[model samples]
Target: MNDKTEELRDIFTDVTDGEETVTESQEDTRGSLERDERSTEERLESVVQQMRERYGFDDVSLSDDELITVAKSFYEGDSDAEIADALGVEPETVFEARMALHLVDEDDADEVDLAAIRNREEDDATLADEYDVDETQIRRYRRIAAAEDESRTANDRYRDEFDSVLADSELSERMTTDVREDGLEDATEGMETDVEF
Candidate 1:
């Protein structure tokens, strides 16, 4: 009995050590993964937020994660029927998401370049006709595009403001002089009075 126990213990120890080596390899691979590559769930969350804001689709009924999975599968060249069957949803739902996200062409599983459409600044009705998707989908895409544009504009404005502040040598010198002579509170008051918010 003692010999059998010792043999089992040795086997368990060997397995444990082997698992640690595999874990180390997995960690290395994990570290090598691209940080910019977002997971499907994260992508779904962003999509859901956009949809909610655009169309007030607060009760979309379907799982956002599952929708993203379907979208990814469709983008990977799977047919709507295939995704529907795999996910146990209606084929139309798959088709709708695929169209809304501009993953593929309306009648075919071929990839569509949504960026090109945005660059053209086509109207929603025109885009709906061109994409052969519903007008609602076109509207959703337009809303998302507008939101992204606003975000980009705000970012550009902030960058310009930051650059302007950094380039203002007179303001920098004044701040330095005031801070040295009048301390931080007085310097900040002077700045508030001199500089517009």
Candidate 2:
């Protein structure tokens, strides 16, 4: 018999007498693992292809190292404080590029979330809910949620901190007054009128 056949026989012989032979399962497991590996590599390659296409880069010519360096410098500078500072570009540019190219590491987001939850504990007064996770977990989720908010700001935390949203949202004075003409008028406090009749 060939080497593979011999190895297979040996594997079968080594199986416990009480258990049925699982030769088919072994083969299936190996096949599934190989398939998963191939799929992961294909995803990475697809991301590389998209970055090359969108940014007008020649895949063979412009290496990821060069692009990452330029992007990092643009988004977060080389020095400690300078990291997030660039001459003419906002950090969002690099964030957008990294997201578009799928180059940013996913693990970082999880870590950031963990840190945020730890820092966002109650003012040493409220009790932790049993239904809720621990302080560490809550901090992590908050950090991650904040990062996601930076990308998509429809959440309450994303709303303006100092400015009154009601005041800003009201376009016309009459409109504000019509709503507030009832008890709802309290909602439009400090909304100045510039409407010309």
Candidate 3:
């Protein structure tokens, strides 16, 4: 029994010799974890450096809660002063945060009236004035409306063509059925001369 156990051990060792050892895998896993940790630290450092440069701070620090507040303020389009007042930070700091983050663009047309621009009753300048946005944004909105209209028109044309094709197919089927019935009647009449029924 001892000799048999030794032979089995030898076979197991030979089979496993070509594979990676447990220690090597553990070391590789450790190396990967260390690399990921360093990468995360470097990214955080870069973000902090950007914030510092934008806000003109010698040493800037932000808690997670402060960051969330800043993001919310930015999304709401609050002024730098308002954001600073809300976050209890300097206006200069809010300005830097806004410049660095840029949650929304100056030319966003979310609140603009696109239909008025499409109708030509309202020009881009007029819409811009009404919406209190840049004229370029109004023009962008108009272009988007025009593209949407074009797509709708193309879709309508395709639908109409499909309906027409369906109608024509039905008409052709009816005509073929009528012709077959008339031919059958004519054939029955022609064969009546040779029948006595």
lDDT accuracy of residue 122 in candidate 1: 69
lDDT of 3 by residue, 1-197 (tens): 69998787777778899443335444344222122233323433444454445445433345534644665555556776887898888975665443333322344335765566678777668878887889877665765565445436545442233233332444655776887788789888856466665
On residues 32-119, what C-alpha lDDT tens digit does candidate 1 reach at each position? Answer: 1223345435645675556546545333445767766765575456887888898898876776554444343344422344455656
User: What digit string (tens of lDDT, one per residue) describes model 2 on residues 81-112?
Assistant: 24225333454444444433333335544434
Which residue pairs show collisions in model 1?
none
Model 2 regions more than 4 Å off: 1-84, 105-107, 111-197
**Model 1: residues >4 Å from true position, as ranges?**
1-40, 57-61, 106-197
Residue 31 shift from truth in candidate 2, angstroms: 37
Q: How far off is residue 156 in model 3, in Å?
A: 34
Q: Which model is ahead, 1 or 2, in terms of TM-score?
A: 1
